[model samples]
Target: MYVAVKGGERAIENAHAWLAEERRGDRAVPELSLAQIREQMTLAVNRVMAEGSLYDPDLAALAIKQARGDLIEAIFLIRAYRTTLPRFGATAPVDTGGMACDRRISATFKDLPGGQVLGPTFDYTHRLLDFALAAEGEPPLAPAGGDGDMAPKPHVMGFLDREGLIEDAPHDDSPPPDLTREPLELPAARALRLQALTRADEGFTLGMAYSTQRGYGRNHAFVAELRIGTVPVEVEIPELGFAVEIGEVVLTECETVNQFTGSKTEPPQFTRGYGLVFGQTERKAISMALVDRALRWEELGEDDSGAPAQDAEFVLPHGDNVQATGFLEHIKLPHYVDFQAELELVRRLRAEASAAQSDTRQEAAE
Candidate 1:
């Protein structure tokens, strides 16, 4: 009896050791602390939390460092960790209407009930790189406002309702379906499918958005409103029998208005583009809105135009980096067995052809 090459287990163990050593490069560089990553590289932490669907900034930061700044890997780490966590309870959805907003603005209305506040945005900054950051100079602080009224959040939809410009946005109190718990099916409900897509990779989401812009299912969109801020998160403790504020989380919310192409029975109404994430990510929110609009082509009676965004099968299947990368990279594993089979078959076929050609030539000569 013949045996195949052994030491597969040993090889795997050594490779893991090498990887661990590589991950902790430059022992003198002072290891990155979770707090530093959480506070300084907050954007990276935010992305990890948003995509991983876990809001712990410190955890996300640690994942990022462990992943060597690979954001997608950090997200994967968070997702894996999230599965082992104990389920306590869920918080009621924060009334975005009651949000103690740090930043709020609307492009649709010149002035609304709640006045626009351009809180923290890089929008107005010049494109030139700052040389001061190289040396890490302390910058002067902007004048702080006193008695900043903690005003209740106001809705952009409310303003449209007052003007009779948009269809009344529905507020259903029923619990939405969980995308993570169930397998995805086509002709999906907006709530279920959108939740799945929100945690989707930024590059993938961006590609879908780009496809929509390139005439796949172009929907004219306006950023009706966008806001980013912190909100109190309350949880109901069963033993205490009372809801209590457990924590606060920062979130980015985006609402977009799109041209409402009406059907035979339905009247012309402005469609909505919605995106909500765990941090102040304007680009992600805006991109999400555009993609959301493109995905609504069927409901809007817009022609498919064979765009990537309009094709649910294509978009949904390829939207996740974790799944896509795993499946794609899995091809590298021990395919030598398959390769050997193909190689033998090709050689056998060639030998058979050569023999047949020689026999035919002899017969012709004779």
Candidate 2:
């Protein structure tokens, strides 16, 4: 239990003032503009948007600036701010199949339709820090690529679907349960699980996904496809009675095809795990896909050998960094009353033991 200390108002105000001062360090240095953060710190902004469940880059950048670049703190700030905003009707499900892909690849296929577009990626770059970046100078422009076909890229999984080699993921038109609006319930549906995993702590999800790769609830996953691009977001207008494109959002999507041997009830078709997240967060998307697959052990007719990723209760509750940080940090608050009670109990127990020993000694002397 934490009691409010009435006398600390002035001290708290002073501390807050000092914190504001600390947040704006070295007055001679020019302040970082929101535009700079939006452009340069794109990945961080993307992470905040994904985890905070908000898509405004400007707001995410502001949160980052206010939090002094502490990502979890920024996410916390963004989440708190999100609670104040008015909610509009939900947007229709984004059509990723029509994505204007910037980067698209498949580990399962050597060469596919629409071919490979490398785009701007750091995959092949040397890890060494360039001192040139420290000295500000405009870099040379990138060479233009060939004017390729403008047709929408077909999903790699579609080929396997035609051959009846992969399990069919029938489209569901029903409204999905909103985790934000309602409390998370156990035995969560796949849609809810995907929602949680998309915004889950990337490191924790990655670790859980890695554990599966190491043979704990192992499902031999092949990255059937990974794509990064912008897709049009459409929402049905009440007046118009038809969906219209509102805007575009960058998203990274992953589809993992896991080996599923034929069961008595089902066929030997390849099972699929899917992940989709805001912006170009491929690692999180991939990890989410792996963990998503692991959690489907019961549905896939595989035995649950007790893997952390497979436990929905364990994964979903702890995946949120904001909630995790809040719970973990709350202990640092004033807990003197609770501690005093614990101390008193320990003292009483020790005194009783000491008295018992003394009585035993007196009995011996008699």
Candidate 3:
């Protein structure tokens, strides 16, 4: 017997209420303030901002708290909120060259014009947990003469270009294609696809990069530069007919030097892998570069090894962990219809085989 039950409106209301309750937990526990999450759980805020493509720490912190620390869900929240935001206008690309760099390092040259600054990193820290933090003690005071805010922006590539060591990169005010709006097509331009790649799921991107390193389609690479810091964002005002500074955002940028094989027509040119994102995420930027280089094998005249990283179809399709994980988990739902069909086929095949064997024995005896 089949009976239909439907409570669409009631069900949705109940779900929302339940989600609210889960987010708040029991009233006895102190409610987590948005500022607390923004300041204290900064790494979570970084992930949410990185994946969400939003730079507001407070909003990201709120999303993290509401999502109960589920970073992806928080990202989804931020993304949803971002959609509702009215676009006042497009911003002029920040002058990375003018950026008052807080942290910058160049791997290509040991000693560059602007001396390397290792601003803040956990690289040298011991792995021991700080029990003092657990007990809640005041953190060390900031050094005197410090406003943590960085100044303008500057690109490390400026020094190289002055000497004409590398090809000059062109800048344009032309609007770039939006992947979110249009259906993705094959042979995607580097700009369009790269934007999508940056906001892609971290784990999926990591796996694709790992495959290249594991010899799937190896591209020898060296990190030429990796930088993390705040850069002022500016927008062009049509009415004002000039650009105005709006805000600053933390960003991570990576440029990888990849060994390339030149074709008969073209001379050997040093190839590049580039990644830029909104947050101090060296790992994501590094992984993004590796994957970016692998995807450029055809353009670079390198033979394709048919690796997932090299195949735009495979990488772009399966690169989103949210989509992949959802389709994967959805299989746990009721599959009895398909199972029943398979069961019938198996039984029919077995009966036919037995009859065929019986006929063969009878014929032999006769």
Top of the candidates by TM-score: 2
- Report the candidate with higher TM-score, 1 versus 3: 1
Question: Taking the candidates one at a time, how many backbone clashes does each contain?
Answer: 0, 0, 11
- Which 10-residue window of candidate 1 scores lowest in summed lDDT? 1-10
> Candidate 1 at 296: error in angstroms?
2.0
Q: Rank the candidates by lDDT, best first.
A: 2, 1, 3
Off by over 4 Å in 1: 1-6, 146-149, 170-174, 236-243, 353-366
Better of 2 and 3 by TM-score: 2
lDDT of each: 0.79, 0.89, 0.76
TM-score of each: 0.89, 0.95, 0.84
> Which regions of candidate 3 fall more than 4 Å away from where they truly are?
1-22, 25-28, 145-154, 159-174, 333-366
lDDT of 2: 0.89
The stretch of ten residues in a row with the least summed lDDT in candidate 2 is 142-151
Ranking by TM-score: 2, 1, 3
lDDT for predicted candidate 3 compared with the true structure: 0.76
Positional deviation of 9 in candidate 1, in angstroms? 3.8
Of the pair 1 and 2, which is ahead by TM-score? Answer: 2
Compare candidates 1 and 2 on lDDT and give the better one.
2
